[model samples]
Target: MHGEPAVLSVTRYHPENPIKMFLLQPLYAPLLFPNTTSDARDHCANERTFLSWLRLAIYMAIVAVAILVNFHLKNQPTPLERRLSHPMGIIFWVLSLACLVTGLAIYMRTVTKYAKRRALVQTGMKTQAVFLVVSAAIIAACALFLAAEVQASRQGHAGAFDVTFVL
Candidate 1:
């Protein structure tokens, strides 16, 4: 047994092919069939964490859509207004994309962590540094968004609460 190669022999499934058992068994077994109840619980928790990240990504995507839809170059007669409008729109667009990409990156990282933890049976909690970094980035983006809005309003593009009632 010491000199024998490491191989999983599943007589009921693939007795004829030991290679398939060696390759596919370990990879799928934990996910498909947990050895213990605690393993199943851990997997469930991992899935929940993954879903939380996915929800955050979706929220960020919604924010991106809102930014794109709400911030646009309206009718501007002056050259300064037009210049400011273009750059402001560009800045908003970049920030929107940054938020979306960062969200997706975080989601993907969570997925990787989940998979690794599942395979390794690790019980370590996620670090607070990640949360702090993400929070700071979000706060900065919000501040920039508000600043741009204020600038646009100051440039007389449109009143902050300008509303047109079409009957």
Candidate 2:
């Protein structure tokens, strides 16, 4: 092998099952797009971030629905409990809805911005930081709301935590 000039034959591999290829195309799609420039990598990263935001938004929505369902399943929810869960559940739902909208809007905006090549990588970083901060604040607010509900339930007093102030 060493004396034969070590010839290597390379061939593109295609899956025999079209269905499997179609299903898995997304996972390998990134490889098809070469990142020859920094902007391309940045754009790719931005897309991944956008998808992450979408996933987070979906998770938040699921949690909100779960809260509502759990409360309804209870034999009885006090007036205060109902008041708290109803409003908080709605708030979570709204936040998640906003997240979805914001994700799409930001993704489009970023794609456009990068396509124009008017901004630098620093701008992208700053935008990501801002998004993260906003997400954290919303999550913190949700946590406080849930914590209050938990405390109220444990104390046997539905009004132990006033969610209005947090709102």
Q: Pick the candidate with the highest lDDT.
A: 2
TM-score of candidate 2 to 2 decimals: 0.52
lDDT by residue (tens digit), candidate 1, 21-95: 335544544223323446556556656665665565566555545444454454323343344444544554454
What are the lDDT scores of the predictions, listed in order? Answer: 0.46, 0.57
RMSD of each: 10.3, 10.6
Model 2, residue 164: C-alpha shift (Å): 24
| Residues 1-167, model 2: lDDT tens digits | 33533221111323343333333433434223224478667877877878987997898787778656544443455455556665666767877877786676666565444434443433455456646755775677567656655665666754464333222
| C-alpha TM-scores of all predictions | 0.43, 0.52
Q: How accurate is candidate 2 locally (lDDT)?
A: 0.57
* Model 1 RMSD vs true structure: 10.3
Residue 15 in candidate 2 has what lDDT?
Answer: 38
Deviation in angstroms for 71 in model 2?
Answer: 4.8
